[model samples]
Target: MRADAQKNRDHLLAVAGTAIAEQGVEVSLRDIARRADVGLATLLRHFPTREALLDALLRTSFDELTARAGELETSSAPDEALVSWLRDCVVWTTEYRGVTVLMAAAIEDPDSALHASCVTLRSAGARLLARAQAAGTARGDIDGSDVFALVAMLAWLGDQPSLAPRAERLFGVVASALLTSAGGS
Candidate 1:
């Protein structure tokens, strides 16, 4: 990409990120372009699709979360690592309103632009869950998919205006339920 094009793309992504954070993943492409001081055609030229723009914006965060899971696995206790990573994932998901829905769909759709990043993130969570289970800290019945689902559920709570206040308490409840002992807090 040329310097000017790359600059435009970066500016568009920055505008899109703010828009999504304020509105949601479903925020209008035209609004994003307007916010970026560009024409709709320019935004479309850079992103091609909403999913593509989201992939570009969110892929870095996804990679960081996956890497965080690995770091937690080695540096923290099994139960602590699992709960900490779970909290981080849920918080990140909540940053972009309605992103949990996209992540859930992306995880199941191989052709989705976000699929690979979602898979890697889910796998990282699964590894932490497995590690905790092996250490007899987390429940053995739940697998990585269950952990992923829990993240979506938690993020959904944060999305709801009525339920937003209860999200933190619910997160603690869910974490407690997942852990065999009282260590999830």
Candidate 2:
């Protein structure tokens, strides 16, 4: 890409990130172009599709989240690290109003542009869950899929207008239930 073209793409990505963060993923591409002071054709040339744009916009954050999980695995206790990362995942997935739904769908669809990032995100949490289970802090029977489902469920709950306020507390309860000690004899 030429210097001007690269500048336009960078500006578009930054503007789109702010717009989507403020207005949700449903914000119009035309509006993004307008906000970035770029023509619609320029935006299209940079990102051929909405998913492509989204994939570009979210890829960095997803990578950061995955990296954070690895850092937490080394820096925190197994269960604490898992729970902390899970909480962070909830926040990441629900940052934009409609993003949780997008992530949930993308995680299951290999054809989606966001699929690889979503898989990486899930794998990060799975690694933490595996560590916790191995340490006997989390339930032995629960696997990475279970942890992924819990994160997805929490993200879904957060997307609900009525349930959004209760999401954190609900997450706490669910996280507690996933602990080995929570299942008292």
Best by TM-score: 1
* Cα-lDDT of candidate 1: 0.94
Q: What's the TM-score of every candidate structure?
A: 0.97, 0.90
Badly placed stretches (over 4 Å) of model 2 are 182-185
Candidate 1, 40: how far from true, in Å? 0.9
Candidate 2 has what TM-score?
Answer: 0.90
Model 1 lDDT per residue over 109-160, tens place: 9999999999999999999999998988999999999999999999999999
Candidate 2 C-alpha lDDT tens digits along 1-185: 89988888999999998899888898999999999998999899999999999999999999999999999999998889898888888888777667877888899999999999989988998898888888888888887777878877898898888998999899989888877883221
> Which prediction has the highest lDDT against the true structure?
1
| Whole-model Cα lDDT of every candidate shown, in order | 0.94, 0.88
